[model samples]
Target: MFLKSVFLVYSLLVLRVYAANIMGLSPFKMSVIQPLLSSSKNSQIDCDHHSVKSSKRWDVVDMLKAMAKIDSTVGYEYEVMHWLRDVLEEQGMTVEMQLVEDEHQSVTGLARHNIYAYMGKTRDTSIVVSSHIDTNPEGNIPYHEIGEEIHVRGACDAKGPAAGQIVAFFELWDASIIKEGDVSLLFVIGEEYNGIGMKTAVESLNATWSKAAIFGEPTENKLSKGHKGNFRFDVEAWGKKSHSGYPELGFSAIEFYLRKANTLLNAELPYSPVLGPTTVNIGTIHGGVAANIIPDYVKAEMYIRVADDIEKVKAYVEELFNTEHSQMTIVQYLKPQYLSFDVPGFELIACAYATDIPYFESIDVKKYLYGPGSISVAHTQAEFVTVTDLYDSVIGYKNLITYNL
Candidate 1:
């Protein structure tokens, strides 16, 4: 243990000393793993000779075309994964599919693979830029496309960001800028439900990874320092199975839940100035056995998005329900969870949604929330990523790398 502490202290000092030479951002906490990209004078090994001549705009558009062409919703990323693996293989890049067991088998229904296409064992590792490959479940969602407007699913929330990362990494790698090491790319899976893919990867503790992790979410490609997260749990109202005629034999769990919901609506949750406000939305609710029979069970799914002590928030939620719905049963509990990004110079907005950042905090990495398109267009029937936005993301990404590494 003493030796470990000594090494940890040494690591931080080494990284701090080298960070100034490379202009890379340091982590919030002490780092034990120093970057291997550092050199004698300057870490910015400019090898513009190995640069590719492809326009990032066209690259993004092409990637959107490819991502939009496939459907990787929940249990079905295999089709798109195979196609992407083939594309990477064609470029002589080594591709591997990280298969993680499905923990949420009752919900996800199948195992998933976190696809990776690495350029090589680059020794000049600078920064690890990553984006999620899987997309939200897009079913019979209606969309439109006008002149120059290309409408499709997974166009923004991720596909475009993924495109930007892929495009940039390939260019740098091919140009030999990343020949020795210093940079790598990581594309994860299962960001929506639970961070199963990232979790699996972290467990592997692969040595050939990057120093810091740049996570791409739909943030208009702006660098976010850090933000809040959540741990969501379920609160259930209980009743009894009885005949409809014998109303007294069963209490209405739905009614109990409704009562609890009314209280929450009237309550004002604590909020931080930075993260804005704490809010809750009961997205899904179900109760009753049949129209004639008195329902024995009722469940209400609670979603709480927060920037402060999310675990405390979860406890508060439980207290809120338990105090009111005293007789109710909690059929299921899913705590509100995610790590919010906060970056200076970034336009702050209330993110009532969730991301994969929370699951990644256990690893020593730099988290950036940036991507193409607006979150407003995400999961919408008319979902689409602006061609201009995709190009903009590439430029922004390059700028981020230029600033940090």
Candidate 2:
């Protein structure tokens, strides 16, 4: 029969394109993520739990529900970065901490900190505000097929832009119009696992390169200026365990690590002008050793994202894994996806997503990147963020540092 009626109309057109990607996250992208997952502890959104900040748009919705009940997640961000450095040292500003670690996430290589606060440094360019208080334990893994609903877990990809960059860092230094030693504030932690607390905070606080470095996440504020830099690795592949009915003396390493990541993902990159072009994401893959045997040794982990000649896109991914898997080998090459901060006149954004600006794309910063919820309601279980976009991003970070210092 016409190829089983053309594979039953191509499996009902792949089940109607996976039910339109689950109706595009439904009209409920943020109806207040299920009443903030019902945590009202006895209901009181307006009934008067001190009527949440009583006004000023209900005190920016009770300060974004007290900074999403502070659960920084990822290897637990030092008690929400010491409750946001005790609310930036209760405004007087002048906090500093950097513990760094020996491994990362817990072999003892963790305990990150870079809570800086400044007020006067006049000019000579310098601005380095960053973000990544981590969160992504995913939880709720009931597995579904492509309807795109990967619920909860740093919901909008960054605690709703770290609760609109901590109310735009106290509406930019408590309205004193951010004093300006060119400006600085960087909070980071494993950026969800492998930024290794912003690479041990720019090599242990020789923080340097600061003419610009704004890198907060929840983007809806509209000034990300640019993103697209990462280059993780790991792809073994050997093979020789045998059994499964003599499969050519065994050899599969996840089928030669998916044919060397589908040949550099079918090649073609190099482009940017507004941080465009470049991306890849195999994410993970490991070896096997069961179901009738025949495994050998596999390993895979991929991540790519760079715009404009990332060393010719990493030498075209090592010449497409040395010509599509000649038994593969690159065990872990990292360090090729940069962005280590960049700024000069400021106002630039493209961030396809991923921050700590590729660990400061080489420094020299003047960074700019506004914040304040609507990353479509981060960490949804009804996660929230609209105390009027956290007091309009604390009056739009005090009018973007009083219109850029």
Candidate 3:
């Protein structure tokens, strides 16, 4: 106990030095700063100690609503990232806007960034709380409240959980339950599409020694057991074009593409009892120029949620699509990802969606997935999360951090 107390004091002194660097103060000046966890600033605080006073507060629902109003679709996440950086800076945390354009080409011609932040400017942290800030482009709804529920794009998918994480960090800091270098926050873009944002972060972030990480996604406030893998491909075919009247003279590209698609729809794919069945989705199709004209080109995009081995799924797809009339191109592929859910009292769930967790497979960290809301309504026009869920998730995240630390 004596050694532990001595180490705690040493850690606080080191944190003060790092804080001085971030606040542009000399080490001597930072040392003279008021006591930690002053009750005068936050009279509402319930921590054990009491000292000075301050007035700074944050809310999960407000943060969620603010982010939901912004359109941070896959390729256009600069504005949302900027907003989060400002919020983190306001809390006196050291923030780094890690550029992600080099990894994935931005469609908006604007720079993309991943927010990497830590209190007191300490690069190394024991725990990391991360979530994506991007949403699908189809439903970019503005912030609006429907009674106890808040309806908006990215509200349930991730922004709500991200907001909860931010608030949880603040509460922990305020109560002095967690101090400098104990935890870090990372919010990345491009998760709805290719996961380029997190891919970039795992390659360059300074937290190599982190022991555990919590990823925020829609899990209905339960701890995720694992999630299905992904295998996406595009099928393209070409045929001669002619007028509708000359039916015999031209070939129908759409018809040919549909035949190939039917072959896949009827094929039997692998499944597992734990992760469930592998699912397929024919996402998009584009080919015809006009109703009267026979189409010269056709293309169909397909995605698979692989519950079985991704290699086996990929091999089956490759052999099935091998033909002269059509060409198949693989877009994205990832194996199923399993996560740690040993925390007692939390319900366990397996998701059918893919996340950025696979990108960190090589890292040795206890990865966990937990957040508020349901994935069923995430990408739809009905996307939303309740105010109760948002508040619950703040506590959920705080529990996970406290347990891990």
Find the candidate with the highest TM-score and give its number: 3
CA lDDT, every model vs. true structure: 0.61, 0.54, 0.82
Per-residue lDDT of 121-175 in model 1, one digit per residue for the tens? 4422557677777777756333345565567777776777888877766666666
The local distance difference test score of model 1 is: 0.61
The TM-score ranking, best first, is: 3, 1, 2
Give the TM-score comparing model 3 with the true structure, all chains together. 0.83
Error of model 1, residue 234, in angstroms: 2.9
Residue ranges of candidate 1 with Cα displaced over 4 Å:
1-58, 102-111, 122-124, 138-144, 205-210, 243-246, 291-293, 321-350
Per-residue error for 153 in candidate 3, Å, reads 0.7
Best by lDDT: 3
Please give the clash total of every predicted structure, in order. Answer: 39, 35, 4
TM-score of 1: 0.74
Write the residue-wise lDDT of candidate 3 on 1-405 in tens digits: 999999988888887776444332345643434344423532322121122122345567656765666678888787678767866886778999999894346667888999999988687899989999989887567656789889888988899999999999999999999999899999998888888889889998756646889999999999999999988889888888999899689988888888878887888888878789999999999999999998889998999999988898888878766666778898778789888998888999999998889988988899999999999989898999999999999999999999988
Give the C-alpha lDDT of model 3. Answer: 0.82
Q: Which runs in model 2 stand beyond 4 Å of their true positions?
A: 1-53, 56-65, 70-134, 138-164, 168-213, 217-229, 232-250, 254-283, 287-291, 295-299, 303-313, 320-365, 368-404
TM-score preference between candidates 2 and 3, better one: 3
What's the CA RMSD for each of the models? 17.2, 21.2, 11.9
